[model samples]
Target: MICGVKQPILLVLVHSAPENFEKRKAIRETWGQDQEGVKLLFMLGIANESEVEKTLEEENVQYKDFVQGNFIDTYHNLTYKHVMVLKYAVYHCPEAKFLLKVDDDVFVNMPNLKIFMKLFMAQNSERKKILCSRMCGNPVLREGRWGVEISEYPESMYPNHCSGFAILYPHDTIFALYSEAQKTKYFWIDDVHVSGTLAKKLCVTHIGLEELILSDDEVVEIVDSSFINNTKPFLFGRMNLDVHQIRILWDFVSKYTPKKVILDYLNY
Candidate 1:
């Protein structure tokens, strides 16, 4: 165990947009009373001062940080937002061990995460320095507004996945990412700009994973046992997971008895 317990510090950064609030609540409800030793930091995204207060009143959840300003527009702007948020965590929330950057619509399988980290820690504590996810090489798309020609990089540069939706970064590495960004202009697309482009420029190595915490539109069924058994646990990214997929994954996990999840934010 890293700190008298096996759980790593968990920070679920959710942009508390209209649709995001209910979605995030559902995710927390999924945890119910099962996740222990996980420190949750709900990140609410707001555009104005009033929205922040309104969010606080409506949700009734204490947030670790309230990120303001609209810095992005297109699909790529997310990268900059993510990088800046991570930077906030690094500079502000130093206690967090592992930072999980996820979208409002996404659902994370926490038990699987715990199991994966357990194995990772068992193998090498140094592994915490690198970002881990199922590596999606930059794709070449010709028909969409978001399509881009994949750039060629040395095998060393293309470590694994480039999907920026859901990624896990250790505390130290996140600091490095923010440091790198300060040296350059903020890019609009946060994934390539912050996670891939900026990180690549800094030479921070990324580890390839098998399962992705972020999903595409496709539906995937993940089992609790299978999740723990996964040799290569990945954070799903890129797919637009519909209701069907969510049900599949949720129902599957429901088969297992949930461990007691507690939230002592005030005491925390």
Candidate 2:
């Protein structure tokens, strides 16, 4: 269990590269602070360089919120990273009500997330679902950056899966998927393999991104409007933002009052 947190309502585990000290620092200083009902942890793989490992150890000594796996830190080993998270959660923080998986670069609106969870619990107390940006029929590229061999994924289109950048899962759902993942064949594409294929195999309920909140366009408009009058966004993704940008956005969103107008647009 992370320090200062007993039984967390939500545990956010961020997948980070071992050398991304700056990104981790930015997150802790910005949105990853230790809240009453929330706990924050960063997942990392072994670093090849001695200096990087030394630095990571030092950071862990100070923060004590890092979960490290044995595999080498590489894009292709993300599946291993995901599995490590599930195992860690099941063993270490089983009492947490929800688990949020996110990448290091994504910006999380923590206040909005807490509000969303409160609304969600009011409706469905069971909390047996996965919530994320849904992706359907994504093509399997044979070459380039996201290349995959035919043997890896023979199907032309991927199964319905949530984007791995940011995903929220109930604790029960996480346990179910984690058990299923052990039986499924390992695939290097973390999002497709874990959230898409394995989730399909287990028949986990996936709540689409649109249902949780309005589209990103409306969110941006709201954020760009009168800062004092704007409503908070549930989350913002695919943002390659720097520390300065994160701090600015965090401060801006923290002050915004959530309005019922935005809630009216939500599908569920």
Candidate 3:
């Protein structure tokens, strides 16, 4: 489907599995809500199971927000899914000013994100760089599902890259990154491959928002505050929170932030 119909300011592409129907719903009802300038769409791969595909189609028919890929939906093909979404954004949503790639489990604080983007856009100097929690010299795993064999990646340390938990990309960077991704060999650890290796190859500058990425302590603050006194101070950093937590956070955050388009960042 065509994008920028509303002349979108931000386009959020969620990396979701086809079967995580509830998680997608939680996102839609919470921070992923589309508004005047912000658009949200889910990117997935084809589910091999007929039942799963049928359910996805039903969901798609109702929402009309999915942009799926040809690859089979599996953990090993994340790179394929990642690249596919970038390609979609570049060709389909070229008018979008920003691209946000966040996984389903992450909790995105839209109010704080709006404030950050408001500030971020003013500084043209930082506009081209990737804004996210930067990961530098992360060790490559050699065991389990996330394992990277020496044959696959000979390096002991991953290049300085943005963690896939959440990444906010300038529209232009998406184009540049997508171009490079096409030429690069596929790497299964999509986080490292896309934001780390491909990014390093292009020499992309990453604006570190380490402080904004919430830790367990910050997550606890939300529950401890009973979701009220403390406004969402962090962004895109909740640890694989449950559906209930997402709803609770949304319920309280909605109470504090206005439903109208955010013109003033500080007030929210």
**What TM-score quantifies how close candidate 1 is to the native fold?**
0.66
Q: List the residue pairs that clash in candidate 3.
A: none
Which of the two, 1 or 2, has more TM-score?
2
- lDDT, candidate 3, 1-268, per-residue tens: 3484586778888999898999999999888886677888899999989999999999999999999888898989999988887888898888887888989988888876777676667755545578777777788889987888999999898998877878888877898889999888888988888888888888888877676666777666665567455543555556587787777767766666534333232210
Q: Model 2 misses residue 12 by how many Å?
A: 0.9
Candidate 2: regions farther than 4 A off: 1-4, 210-229, 261-268
For lDDT, the strongest prediction is 3
- Per-residue lDDT of model 1, residues 1-268, tens digit only: 4422354466556543433554555555663223565655445434335664576556654533345435422344555567657766776566666777766555555666666555555555564255545445654343476554334222233323345556677666777777888887654445656666667776766665433443332233243233422232333423344444444555545455334321111010
The candidate that achieves the highest TM-score relative to the unseen native structure: 3
TM-score, model 2 to reference: 0.89
Looking at candidate 1, the ten consecutive residues that score lowest on lDDT are 259-268
Which digits, one per residue and each the tens of the lDDT, describe model 2 over residues 1-268?
5434865888889999999999999899889987898888999999989999999999999999899999999889999999888887787788887888988887787877787776776777666677887888788899998999999888888998888888888878888888988889999989888889888987776777654443445445544553355443455534555676567667877777566533443433
> For every model shown, what is its TM-score relative to the native structure?
0.66, 0.89, 0.90
Per-model RMSD to reference:
8.3, 2.7, 4.0
Whose TM-score is higher: candidate 2's or candidate 3's?
A: 3
Write the candidate numbers in order of decreasing lDDT: 3, 2, 1
